[model samples]
Target: MNDKLDLKSTDITSLNIEKIAALFPNCVTETAEGKRIDFDLLKQELSTEIVEGNKERYRLEWPGKREAIVTANLPTTKTLRPVREDSVDFDTTENLYIEGDNLEVLKILQESYLGKIKMIYIDPPYNTGKDFVYKDNFAKAGNEELLESGQKDEYNQKLVVNPETSGRYHSDWLSMMYPRLKLARNLLTEDGVIFISIDDNEVHNLRKICDEIFGEGNFVANIVWQKKYGPANDAQGMSDTHEHIILYAKNISFWNPILLKRDEKQLAAYKNPDNDPRGVWRASDLSVRTFSENCYFPITGPNGQIHWPPESTSWRISETKFNELLNDNRITFGVAGTARPMQKKFLTEVKDGITPQTWWHREFAADTKIARYEMKDLIPENVFDTPKPSLLIKRCIEISSREGLILDFFSGSATTAHAVMQLNAEDGGNRKYIMVQVPELTTEKSQANKVGYKNICEIGKERIRRAAQKIKESLNQDSQDGKGLNQDSQDLFNLGNQENQANPGSDNVQANPGSNIDLGFRVYRLDSSNMQEVYYKPQEYNQATLDLFADNVKPDRTAEDLLTQIMLDWGLPLSLKIERKTIAGKEVFSVAGDSLYACFDHELDEAFAKEIAKEKPLRIVFRDNGFKDDTAKENVRQLLKQLSPQTEMRVV
Candidate 1:
């Protein structure tokens, strides 16, 4: 109970080494630095043929590729702290809006959301020379170092605009996308897919890396979307009117796309002029392109006019089948009953819905113009230069998944969150979302700053709030007007009818039927670890003073901050609703009934222990040095073991 918690993200390099060592122990060798794999032995184990390093192999590589991979594998000490004032329903909302560098945020989410995300849609920077790409880490350089390096200022900033004239423009952009994509792959479910919106600027490069990250075989389709209705006057050779959406599933074999409902235009193709009992139908050619001995017979219309097949063509069915269909009134001719025979195709007989095509016009998916208008409607300013329309994201949501967790790391204006809420109201599906955006500051001269939006996160959070309210109002009006949800409410799945349970890390929100729309979202900001570091030496400090008896937590941190770190360290979801209670003078935090219990308050004695043990939570934790002495800690541990043997107790 007195031991400290592991307050760091998972180290992927070490985890991979462990996995390899388990398979071939002999291949793993201990070095002065650390344990590493013997390439010769690993090659022999993997292949039956001789391995050669000079062999040519097809692959995409560039400067910083190795560094990007290393960056993805490295662990971080950063942690997310709750921002209650910025959140809506801080304790209950399954949705999340995180403000931080997405790379660090992705690492933090690795444990709690691994293989849990069902869909991802990110509209990342297109790297058009003007857009700033993440520079990864910012190093504060000294004046001498800056002078030696011929740089203007101290350590490079986190985001730097990449001009086309720069030597490594393309390489820099690729490196930035590589690590983020690599980490993102770990969060997608087996049947999940990612939809990335990109223009011609980096669409090809994006596809190449996507092939490397998500298997090439899993490449689904490249949808060409019409984003513009007309051409701009300042055109360079030709005006760009479309963009591409690259789709890739984690496992192509497991991919199951939800078919789109037929629109009015598609339905207009089917009609019944003669009023058939089987409902509206369309006529199909009764002739076959290939000649068949059994299907070459002629047919007589209702007016007793003999009809022959087109030149070199034959009847689609045999004489016996044609007679059977004729008896059932499945064959149709001209209204005058003097034309070639045709088969009646009933609209109700279709078992498969409309399969989406690779081409999407602005009418169906919406355009960037509509996106800007949407933001202006809520913000009343051109603060955000680029904002994807909620309908566009909703299209991706409907096709990729009907419910479950959705993620958008490059959540520019939180259009993904708005779409999730809007879709939930329309279909009554409890689809939770997590929007990760870097809190890059708005320009001082921009309208956003004048309106009090300090950063991009401020704009995003406000958009989500306003979008939620508008959606609720729209739903209310629709219900009152006797028009509940739109016709598409008949989507394949509606999770609101049953209990939705989250798993592995117990991030459960217990979303069930008859609940109001989950318009609320919890907000968390990334920051340094809450633990305080003690720098001491044998000559400077006594061993007794620096022992385990002392409190190592930073004074400024609250119990909630410590609990947030503890939750991440213990693989608990931050979205879980924490119920606070004072059990025998100590504030106890309970999550999901008896799933977890934590008391960060000081002086946790037998009274608090007994009260908590009665519930016998699955897991329990206490703050280090919270007891009077070692004896009290041991006694509480033993007492809990005797009373609640199944509970796993620890301290942080």
Candidate 2:
């Protein structure tokens, strides 16, 4: 067997073309300028064609440290991640649903979406004395003996979760989340923000973690959402009805979320009871910021009596502005001129402020029941438990993201996807999503298993499909009733079409006469990580030396093509050349500008091997099972060093 190439021995920077090709006089020749060149010396060169064979792949080099450190072994599973492709999807969307272990999915996205995400909302396992599963190394579990005894399998490796009841509850959760958080940090764009939802279980810990990950300087407000309008009925002591959402940003110095728009309900509060030609208005304060010594003087009302300021809260404007309002009758006092002066605030003048107070569930309720209902309606009953409300998701998305990309790795029930569709329907906006999910085998005792689902990801896709169907149905219903919701139905598909008609199939197909909504989300399933290639089986016929070698006729394929493949596998640049020639009734190929040479004629001679190796390619790889003579192989190795001392050779 040939040893692996000693990569350490090949110094790319030290290579010099002129000096190395000097030894192989027959195989190499010099140009007029004394530049070394390989002659057409017939030898088996690297195969360019992707033949039917497994390829040995290489990975990026790992940095080495001198000291060895002991670490816990953890179990891990190959997690699938998502990628988004640019395409038209309805008018606009902003929600996403990812269905995978967020840790792995986040890592997979680090390269393509680093520093790009705006908001990240996750409801992780509360770790309330139950086993929270995450992929980890198994060796730390004393499974080395089992592995060595062949009691364990490789592909079906199992990862164990540390239950929260364990003494290291906090430690375990932190360890599991650290790397994932590190990766997620890279996905946040500079001005991006993140919102994490959590219960008391680890709210403090989560805050500290965010402070570390997003930098304490960027820590935004901690919003306390009234997840439940009523208190928990079965509370041991106190009923908990609220949850905290910790907000942070990639760069607080530049990050600012869009203020929530006031709904029509709020707008309906103002009325123009006394039409003053300024439209509808609300009453505001009329007092000055401070009781100005000069302004403390009595202001005569329409009755010409002294009007005193209020006891505490003062006005935002100066007395000058107040008098101006009084002159324009913008300031209103008592019904019969007996009340204190009040400024009139026109509805048109006030900017919609950020939603007030930390408590939000009052405005946006978290009816887990509603989410469950949505899931059951879309998928098999009880396939999933807690799903964040679409309203909650839509709110978060509206505040943080524009018409940009959204990602969800823990896409349970696909609520985020539904929210994106619903929000887009509400207000036209285009936002894309990439969802990643793992096909973790379903537990036999789980309801989803009874329904024949393999895992959560399966349910996730079904939910998206069903949601899209519902959205289309709802939009179509609206369109038939002559509602604006029909705008989203622009992509309706009809049944009839000529098989060969090519106007970009969907573009030419007319929408169903009554249809109203377009199915917007595209689904993709992630497959095993592998670079696919095609190959052919080598011919079975065996011949010591055929006329193919004797006539110096080359294979239809060129050596340059084969060399390119070798470079791909070797992780070398593809821009290398080859010189070909016939040698002793055999064809040989020498890498252009390099000492590398290859031949697989089985009838190779020792003298010919010496001549080829004389011009040392930095490294030479060959088929180990191909050489016919053991003595000749040994002689070739000995002569390789003699002819090209610096060349490292290998056989595979």
Candidate 3:
């Protein structure tokens, strides 16, 4: 995986560090706070030296627009910590469900997921004047300012408020979304596309910023989706029945939407009324709107009636083609034998699919009513307001990806994940998803709180678990009763309510295994770096701080936490298959089968290094204090070199 890395300018700070490390590996040493450059050692190595975005994004500027730019460029010391208790198939699942502020989460995933995501769909808050809790101000001067300013959620994170009465109502919402989108663009593949769902509140403003961020040429469409089946009887104003979904691609030239497959209702239009041996066919108008003197010929129907093109219109085909069609019995007349000639469109002669239109009806894309039904089917309580139907999101998935990575940063009830699972089950595809949601606390007076769902994340995770159970049960019932639901697995989107349903286990794809309809997702909560304390100066520092860090790595942090940090630092995906083993009285984690190896135990010797090097892993990482002394650290590296010169080793 680490063969000649691509020289792309992404995550500037980290990539430059890697380049420096390559040229002077000794200068790049691990500290308690993760990797750090050893300046003194680097000075020796150089004696000589070391070698190591967007334009006019402000087309329509808001109050906090500059702060939004600063936020996107800022570095985060935070890292994702694994939550095994809340996870399904922790070490095996390829799907990810992360709980954190999406802005920070986007920044953290930049390196690992950069330009890898195929499609992104976010249904963010509509800025409807509600008193929505917001993040700490990016432009605020200091922590004291935040402490004097906003409310802290259950997790103790500072949160401000945005209300209709506030002066910066629309500006606040735009600021919140700007940075997130800026970072998200980097995570998309060249052929990637993003769909954002918004209502009238900020749709116009959203378009302006999106045009600046994604570029005007990348603009695809502003689909008008029917969100309601009927109008509200209450006479407040014209009842709002529709919302907009804006589509944009990473590069317009590199991508195109997949045509929608013809459904049963559309296909039913065709029938073999004449019992033609060719196939079932439907009558199509054969007149052209534009005037063409050469195509103004009349046609003789099979019923011995003469037919002419409609008034002001000409025949679509030339006289020669019309004669050929007449000879082949491809023209049709009215059942009464007095109508004009029409062309017969055989089902077998047309394309298998139809191009999608900008207009989406509720029949194909479920409305708000069905969305509530789906939420009730799983939680049976009003945990979310204005939830989107899983089928609605499934429509987006169908248009976006057939088998690729899908991301949903504003995953409220996790409808995107639900849709992905249903689509994969139906087609036997190997699509994977990553859902990120902030653990927004439920108000004490809310139904979700009364039902014991403390936060939105709790509800989201529960929905995925129950949805998986529902899919698995459906598959099983089909196998037993032979109802053939497996072929029509999209029915799973219905996700019906069942009384006394037990939460069931899920399946995993491992990080590196062959893809499947993976039912499980790994859980990770964002937290500060695992480093307890780090030392800087080489001899004046290395030994003591390294020893202190090894002896204690954040009392609250576990070995898995350390492993995850290492994964991020190394640019290895956190989903890689990991195997835990104890060797020479030390705990070693084997990641992706010899791609990398790590041991954190104290007193590591040459023998232990030799044993591990026997397999010749691509890289090895060890805790600095894992060895007896400075002498022992050098000895282990030397031992590994003698045994497996192909292996790269590092000490933290």
Q: How many residue pairs clash in each candidate?
A: 0, 48, 1
* Cα deviation of 316, candidate 1, in Å: 7.3
Over the stretch 506-625, how does candidate 1's per-residue lDDT look in tens digits? Answer: 111222224478889999988877875552223555677668526777777888888888888887778788899878888889987888898888777777778888889999988777
Model 3, span 1-652: residue lDDT tens: 7799788767787777789988998776544344567777776666665433123244686667888889889987678999999999877788999998888889889888989999999998778887454564655544555574454544444446667756467777888889999999999999999999999989998899889899989999999898875677884889899999999999999988887777666778898887899999999989989879899987776677777777898999999998898789898786676777888999899977787788987666767776887788778888888689887787788877888889999999999988888777765777889999888888899999999999889999999998887777666665576544333323322332122132211111112212256899999998877765442233556665666654436668677888887888788877789998777768899999998888877888877887887779898888766788888889998988899999999866
- Put the candidates in lDDT order, highest first: 1, 3, 2
Give the runs in model 3 whose Cα sits over 4 Å from its true position.
Answer: 1-58, 131-133, 139-149, 154-158, 334-337, 484-516, 533-552
| lDDT digits (tens) for residues 587-611 of candidate 2 | 6666545646665456454777676
Kindly indicate the candidate among 1 and 3 with the higher TM-score.
Answer: 3
- Candidate 1 global TM-score: 0.80
Leading candidate by lDDT? 1
TM-scores of all candidate predictions against the true structure: 0.80, 0.60, 0.83
The better-scoring model by lDDT among 1 and 2 is 1
